[model samples]
Target: MPPATATTPAPPTAGATDRPGATGAPGRAVQVTWAVATIALVAVGTVRAAGWLFALCLVAAAVTGTLAVTGGRSPLGMLVAATLPPAATVRALSWAVRGLRDTRPAGAGIGVGRILKSLAISAGLLTLFGLLFSSADAVFADLLTGLLPDISPDGVVGWLLRLALIGGGLLGAAYLVSRPPDLEGLRPGPARPAHRLEWTLPLVLLDTLFAAFVLVQLTVFFGGAGHVLRTAGLTYAEYARGGFWQLLAVTALTLLVIAVAARRAPKTTRADRLLVRALLGTLAALSLVVVASALYRMQVYADAYGATRLRLFVTTVELWLGLLFVLVGVAVVRLRAAWLPRLVVGTAVLALLGLALVNPDRLIAERNVDRYLETGRLDVSYLSGLSADAVPALTRLPEPMRVCALGQIAAELPRDGLWGTNLGRERARRDLAAIPTTTGVTDCPGTRRW
Candidate 1:
């Protein structure tokens, strides 16, 4: 025997981890759970009409599908993880098709083709017997009719098409779950820090600019309407509208600048880290003021001309941006931002879900209606264009305004099937049924667009 020699195991090959049974593959039970979840989420669309409910279903499906494929083990940033599922689903389609094609039995296992054939035969026999019994007994026929779904000939093609598309998508997702991609390998190397002068000067200048803007904002806040009219030679609404978009742009650009500065700032020493925190932290704090100013401008604008979708949406976005600034400030203090990416994405998803739950259309209608009661200024045409979600609120308006606001919505209200029903539309239908249908208002006052 050769004098004791040490043996080393070979290193795993590239992409080996992406294969089935590899470390990245989800366990069988996990796969089944996620698969069922995915199916249930997709099935929601077949049952619910498009609205907030559909939006929620979409979000759930995306999350569950991503979790299934990545096994929730992706090392990539949350932004990348959010986008990976769709691409993975598309890439796995061919693999799923090939799998279905090659269905020969392994060892003592049953063949897929044999199982499918047995199922087909069993279904055919059951159908034949069902038809024979239906002709033999009227009560049995009625019971069978009640038990089976009514598959109309007109909708059979569409139903089959939907089934095939959803089935194919599910199959692709299943394949990806069994064999996740090498996402960890795709994560980029750490960024190289810029030279001190390279990143420092821009950030310092930005801080100075933000400071100047904050000073102006302070002056405006304390100065009030008289100062704005005198200095800018513009009314409150004019001033608000003029600067709102510009301030929004500035806030967005400031966030980008902070991100770049944080990424490029060197942190090799305590002094460097402290400086980074001081500059970026101040910028984020000032950015919060800018967010506040943008929101205040929108409030003035909405006060001048009631609430609309655009104004409400922008306000929500500004609020989310304000929260982002707060998050950045916290991340800066800790000198550890690894959690920032995921938290940012999570907060965004929550914000969107929150917005949906609040029923934006309804909110908009309610705000406009309240403003009308106060200022006697109601935009009937605009309210009429709102979705069925606003029906309940719009119906609260006085006679002509209520009729005008609900005419279009009620006219366009779709009669969704049992599976395609939505709470919002159902409520709208019930409310509309109770109200008289005389088109009693030909010309609604304040029909002008704001």
Candidate 2:
């Protein structure tokens, strides 16, 4: 679908009350409340996560993701959107101030000189503000180290950070690309940035390679993109690390295609529009698969499971959103199909709002507050970067600690002496020895494995 023009945003609501087939209309407060609530949650989460580095990673993820979504192409939007709230959120917001400085949104249909001027200002502001908020060394050092210094090669944590940052960059790019177009001193789509083939050829080649890989995996291996990779028993981080190539490919392809489609998508007939609708739906489904795969990966790792695992693809979510938007878009285009548009939009809004309220994550977050809470063993290793933490966190655990300690204690005991627990038996023997009727020594119990 093409980008929303400066005209209208979505379907109408007033007409919806007359019709019964559509989803109900949600109050305006629904969206408003959700946004404020979400922002508050962000504030709380930033605090709960603790440490400037973690916050920065998140800021970077959010910043990048915002850049990509608002500017870049559709599939790019899809991919970034799918990975977000985790990878995207973590990195965009991590250096958000810096991201705003280093990377900012640009507009279309603007003259080259003016566009460049605006971009310069945007970039300068983002950079200046970023510097004010975050330090250089403070963040980079933490990226290489897990918050827990001990978990040297934190495969899971590191992978999460990596995926989020990468997604954020892609999202930011998409946002810029999808923007109307630079206006100042520019005709459209500049040519003399030094290299055309350098950009196009590489993108084309990378996208092609990814497509081929996805095709191979889909046909000969999994039957289709969704079946094998995200069947079940996967975790979010696992899927991210395990199927990153495919995820990246799908996201890139989707964004590129959508970008192209938006630019050239024909509107000759209702059928053409329908085709676009179908295409968007398919894309949405793919996005859902990407998300589902990620969620499943997380679930597997966390020993968690949920109902919406398969529906996680961003495409799926957006597909539903598009349906409502489509009615609005079509109604706007036709102008004659008036009464039904509002009703359709209102219903869709209500449905979408309802979905948000019923979102399993909202419930999950509420239900498992204890697990999400920050409390556990004396993990000083994370703060200290102990040599032992470099070993897998699971490797040197409660059982291992107990087993090793017990064995060392057993080795030093005298074989000839009656075996007894160090404290109890010795105390018993000593206490008994003071009594005339008591024996000289008390027999100790056999050594026991802890």
What are the per-residue Cα lDDT tens digits for candidate 1 across 83-112?
766676687777755655766646766644
Determine which window of 10 residues in candidate 2 has minimal summed lDDT.
381-390
lDDT values of the candidates? 0.75, 0.38
Model 1, position 230, has a per-residue lDDT of 95
Best by lDDT: 1
| TM-score for candidate 1 | 0.79
* Cα RMSD of predicted structure 1: 5.2
Stretches > 4 Å off in candidate 2 = 1-42, 52-54, 57-240, 301-450
